[model samples]
Target chain A: MKLPAKAAQPNSENLPFFEGAEKGDLVLPRCDDCDFVIWFPREICPECGSQKVSWFKASGKGSIYSSTVTRRIPGGWSKVTPFVLAYVELDEGPRVMTNIVECDPEHVSIGDRVEAVFEEATNRDGESGPPLLRFRVTES
Target chain B: MSIKGKAFIAGVYEHPERHLPDRTLPQIHADVALGALADAGLSTSDVDAYYSAGDAPGFGVLSMVDYLGLNCHYVNDTETGGSSYLVHAQHAAAAIAAGHIDVALITLAGKPRTGGDAPGGSGRAGGAPEAPFESQWGMSVPGGYALAAQRHMYEFGTTSEQLAEVKVAASTHAQHNPHAFLQDVVTVDEVLESPMISDPLHRLDCCVITDGGGAMVIVSESVANRLTRHAIPILGTGSFVKSSQSGRIDLSHTGAVRSGPLAFAEAGVTPNDIDYVSVYDSFTITVLITLEDLGFCERGTGGQFVASGALRAPHGELPFNTDGGGLCNNHPANRGGMTKVIEAVRQLRNEAHTEVQVPDCELAVAHGTGGSLATRSASSTMVLGRSL
Candidate 1:
């Protein structure tokens, strides 16, 4: 799917996060000093300020912490209308912002179980880029 | 030592014309700053310190100082989002009390509509950077606040209609305000029927976008005593800033949870003693969250408290945002806090237009929230009392 060029480019600090998504794994940084799972992949642990951080695959399972239906889409957001943007609290104890696909925006509710899913990302000009992660409501 | 009652607001002014499409940003800053000094019965020559946002019009505080042609010994240009000016007041009070300075001027001016640089949104760098991962999801301003609204509903059974009550009350006040951008009386039904920006927040839930500026002159109690105009005492102040780090945010509460009590304790009053409130209303949820966090009601009872219409009309148990607030009134870019301060000053002095005036307003709370909910945020609250 088409994504903004900003969405396609991963900064140096978060490169490993995108690299894992390409391999179909939801990897998050885990702090060795504090056992804190850091999302958005920082070099140092926010909880304990330790440099001893490593990437590990997450359970790929989470529940909707909170959500909103974006009826007003700003420029560069892939022209998706009435999509569900949500914060998913993963089983690994970190929350990530992702879009909920495969269902109507109004149908998604807080505390609903979801699973991480990755899709091929394309630049604004339709060039291939890193894989983007999203979430889908799991079947009951 | 506490800074309580050490500083007083001598003068305040909100530019009468909020939408200045043709004026330059520096011009807005100059106009409001000078206008406020005039209101205080003082000139720039009497000011010893200047306080403003570093990112304000004309670039940083020095540029504004240069543009305004003011020579000051001290300057503070802290940028804490929309609440920056309120925080500046807090800092100014302490500085004055400590004998660091005698007179302080806090200014906020931006051209959100005319200058092509609106204040709210996520794309800025510095301070708290956007999560590289979350930026890809394409979140809007309303969407960020919507997450908090959604969570509040999930946890406390808050209803959309209840949120609508906030808009309705603000509109009721706006109807009596001539300077308000929106004056047509709006009902809860009308708010619910308005176009939705996010799920629970409608177009009416959000503040109007207008380009304007406001200024305040804060002086030491000694200087206040000499001034001709009545001095509004700065009784208490509190502020808190939170980064967008995960696991630290309780969406149900906000930084106001910490700042509110500190201000109240300093002011020697509780929420029950407040005669009027000027809590920020960037969105309906902004007001609800602040009301709960500032001890207006129990944490989960904001929906019921607001729905009672206790915040509306001539007999509101606790009159709030009586000057139309940011919702239907003028929102000068992101400097919504200064207007909140001005409203409190007016209510305390019994200078508010007759319709929205709260009789014998003795204590007023002016609170502001900036950045986004569901992300890193900043909050500042101030308690102002009429000098006895």
Candidate 2:
């Protein structure tokens, strides 16, 4: 998917998560000491402050923890007005920021069942990058 | 050690014009500073320390000092976004108590409407230092607050009408203040009918963008004793920084719950004792959530609490945001905390305009929320009174 030009470039802490997205997999960091899955991919576990962490792929299905229909589009997002921006909680734990697509933005709500899907988007510069993770209602 | 009631805001002034296309940022700052000094019955020579955030026009303290010709021993630019000024107030009070400086001047100015580049938006940039995952999905400032409003409705059955009530109340108060940016009274229906910026948040549900600024002068108790003007006491102050992007926040509650109590505890007062309030209303949801977190009502009941027009001015149960709040009055371009503090000082001193003044308002609470709603917000709460 061609991400927006302003889309945050992945770094050492979150490079693996982006790589997972590019490969059509949902990867996350887990602290080995406390077995806690961390979102936003941090080098150290916030729970135990343990540097001993590893990355793992997980089941993509999860429920919508919270969702919003954003109408204000800045720069690159002008194409997708009134899109469903949601925090999807994975079955393995930890909520991720992804769009709830393939459904009416207004129809999406908290506690709705959703699953991740990957799509390619190109920026205005015609630069195609990683496959962005998006979610869709599963119960429907 | 608590730094409560040791310092006083002896002087306060705000730029008269809400939108000054002709004036630059530093010009606004200098105007307000001189006005506040006059209000305090002092001259520039009396100020020993200075505090500000961000930049004025294109310069910082060094240029401002040279331009304003201020001679000072202590200076700080502790920028914490909108709530930085409130935190500056807290820090200044402590510094005075510690004998670091005698007279402290804190100021804020911006030309958001005329300067083209107004200050506001999400909490912080996405990635690296913040939650990369959240920022990567393209979350805007209102988008984050929308999530909280959504959760509130789901959990408490809060309706859009309840949120609209907040805007109506602010607008009603603004109608009484001539300097307010939007003084026309708006009904709940009108608020609900406004265009949607984000889910569950309409245009009126959000704060207006305007160009304005305010300034304050704080002095040690000893310095205040000799001043002729009413020196509003800094009864108590509290601050908390909670990042919402990375941490697992409930989204329903915020740092206000922790910070509000700290201010109240140090002030030796309860919510019921507060006669007036000045809370940052970056959005309608901001006010509702803050009222609940501040212990004015039980969690999840904020919607109902504000529904009865209890927060409206000119005779509401609680005269909140008497300056019309950010919703109707002004947001001072980028920073909002300074305006809230200014209003609380006005209310406590019985100096507020006759229309919005709270009768015998001896105690007031001024609160500000900075950053984004998704990631934890930085909440600052202060309790001010007429006398110790």
Candidate 3:
């Protein structure tokens, strides 16, 4: 994340990463042992324990688990609460907690399916970077 | 890992001013300490050891040992971040079981609630700079969760409405708790309308902040028996660390997946055997993850399991978070562990009041998490039941 491509800054700072609506590619640090893709990419491969880790792509389709819609956004990040907070199980294996965006924020139902669509935009960090990965409710 | 008798939580106290008179971490801690001890009708001198999370101005074990003018056999100040105090309780029980110390006191107090973080207090308390990749990528505490929450949504059919159920249930408990800070009867619509702090996470999805402190005391089976006719002994405790997140584990499963079995084996019980639960709900995800991880539901099915109405009662199912929890209750960040454990203690001791409580509750379990899901987060669970 050090001097990352900006979108990758959050990937580096390792906390409070703000991204726009377009960075939807499920890219993360990779495995040196097999170069297999890893979610929440980090130093080593959970498979081979290889220290040589790099970014890799993820399958963006999965089912919606549970989600919460919040009304307040503290720390000046308001304007989106009472919004949906979701836990989606990726087709790849990890269950990610995130927001489901694009369509009617409602009409999002349990078991209603989704697919990742990247919306490219700059984050508040001033990095007109990678398209944020946002989920749109697709098929059941 | 095993308790001979029920270790009832006899003392529970909070000091909002431990950050200063009006402000001093030690004083804040003392208020909670004294309150808990007084509630239990015990004296400071009767306390044998101390346990806590985070660092204060002092540099020694039981930093306030002399300041509080008390001394004992063992003490724990392992700043394992949020779950530190829970770990301290487990460690204290272990120590007491091993004949190390008795009448142990575990407490927590910090300045973060006052809108000011102490120097070098980044959960690591200025420990070694975090691993380079995490720091280099600029990933943050909530982001890791966002990443996981996003993944969970991707895999399961969970929805915002279900997550709202958690906060709603917790707020219901908070409404009952006179001490809880955020007790608004927010609606699912309201929660949905809240601003997005992170995508998928509304501001309400996060825990609230308040300046406060807390303390708990544990003692040996013998001392506990003499002091009180009834005690809620710690039956079994477990701490599991996957160490590094290579690839074998999924974000949806917790160390509890491993620890729950180990703890059950140690305690000689099953999930159905338990009556109530005090889950650590750092966010909606933590609860979702643990629900599946703790075997409350099968993997990949947690989303359905939670929203199923099985969690609600007369259905007579086990109640969870009974005290509003970190989500709708005490979320002092560092004291998150203490709050869950204390609530479990109160329920087991049959002490929680109306607005939220169990009738003649007996058994309960508490879980705590320290690091973000992206890293080596420590997961600890303690199974508590009343001593007959």
Candidate 4:
């Protein structure tokens, strides 16, 4: 299945998360003070207002909290028709927006077990971009 | 210190044409501004405060205020997606109550239909914190809401037919509205038969993309009393933004769960006291979920509440979206907040179409949900009562 072009530009706050993706690792930030795992990695902890956030490798295991099979794709992603977009609840207690891949789009269900799979994105110019972190259903 | 009865909705105007490719964005803004001022028996000179959202073109409030030639002292460009206008209404009323501004004008306009950009299209600024994590997935507007609908169905046993009932009721009201984009009444089967844009949400479940706009004139109590038009009292207003909670997301509820109670508490009324409602119907699931969040029914019972025809106008226990709502009516500029308030004003003024007009409608609620239902979203609720 075709994936959307990597449109995210790495910044100072989120650069670590991208750097981890380059090594095929699902890295997440956790607040040392509050013990809150921050999704969409940021510099400060939203819970405790602490800049003392630490990065660690996550288990890469999660369950589908909710999902939708998008039949109508928009703009440049029209080529990626019939893709399953979902929110996966991580085993470490954070939810991440991701695509459920390597399975029939229609067969994906809420609460299904999934694991992180980093796929390299390529633009029309055949230029490679950052590895996109997607999820695939794990065998029961 | 409450804004209750301190300010009133003096005038409201919804642009007639759903498609206006020939008109520029500023022209539509001017049209609605003048239309509302005219309806209030006021002029541009009387407008001292101007309000707008992100839909305002160019420099936002600065450009619209100068283009409209309004000599204003108070200006607000607070944007919360589609719910921005409702938040503006609340802010305008507060300003009026505080004696900062007597007359406030709020306008919204967009050409998304002609421009071919759906609301919430990939318009996020580069380097937005969420973009790195969420943008990679092909998440469309419908896709986000479909996730919520799927979870709701899994947890509450909500059926597609029950969700389709929302579209049926909207189409029923649209048939009475001559200017409605889709005036032909439809059935549950038709809604089901429509192609699924996203799983659990059919094409019929989505709102129309219109190029027109709308405006409202809110005034202080003294200004409202001096006007000839029937002024609808602004009883209470509440707003809240619900986000992913740093990844601990719950799809079962919306920000309405908080905003509804806050508004109801300030209005000194319960949900039972509301005579009419205009909940934003960006999707059928939106109406169903909002009804529960707004206390119209118990949680997990919205399916049965809506399927029982409670939203049908003229006779339902609680008539809603008498203007066909965004489901069948015009979702101008991809923002339904302005139209939601306009229809509530229409209902209170007894100016609604004879077929869908709620008899002796006194108190009404106009609520809007902006942004996506499954992701970060804003909910604004306003309570209105007929002037004494």
- Ordered from best to worst TM-score, the candidate numbers read 4, 1, 2, 3
Clashing pairs in 1: none
Using lDDT as the measure, the top candidate is 4
Query: Native-vs-model 2 lDDT?
Result: 0.82
Q: Which candidate is the best by DockQ?
A: 4
Worst 10 residues of 3 chain B by lDDT: B129-138
**Which one is best on TM-score?**
4
Candidates in order: C-alpha RMSD to true structure: 2.0, 2.4, 6.8, 1.4
Tens digit of lDDT per residue, candidate 4, span B116-182?
A: 3568842334555676777678788888899999999999999999999999999999999999999
Kindly provide the TM-score of model 3 when superposed on the true structure, using C-alpha atoms.
0.74
Candidate 2 lDDT over B197-284, as tens digits, reads: 7888988888887787888999998999999999998888989987653445678877888889999999999999999999889889
lDDT winner between 2 and 4, please give it: 4
What does candidate 4's lDDT look like per residue over A35-74, in tens digits?
A: 9999768988877889999999999999999989888866
How well does candidate 1 match the true structure in TM-score terms? Answer: 0.96
Per-model TM against the reference: 0.96, 0.94, 0.74, 0.98
Q: What's model 2's lDDT at B174?
A: 87
Better of 2 and 4 by DockQ: 4
Q: What is the DockQ of candidate 2?
A: 0.58
Candidates 1 onward: DockQ, in order: 0.63, 0.58, 0.11, 0.80
Docking quality level of the chain pair in candidate 1? medium
Whole-model lDDT values for every prediction = 0.84, 0.82, 0.64, 0.90
Which of candidates 3 and 4 is the stronger one according to DockQ?
Answer: 4
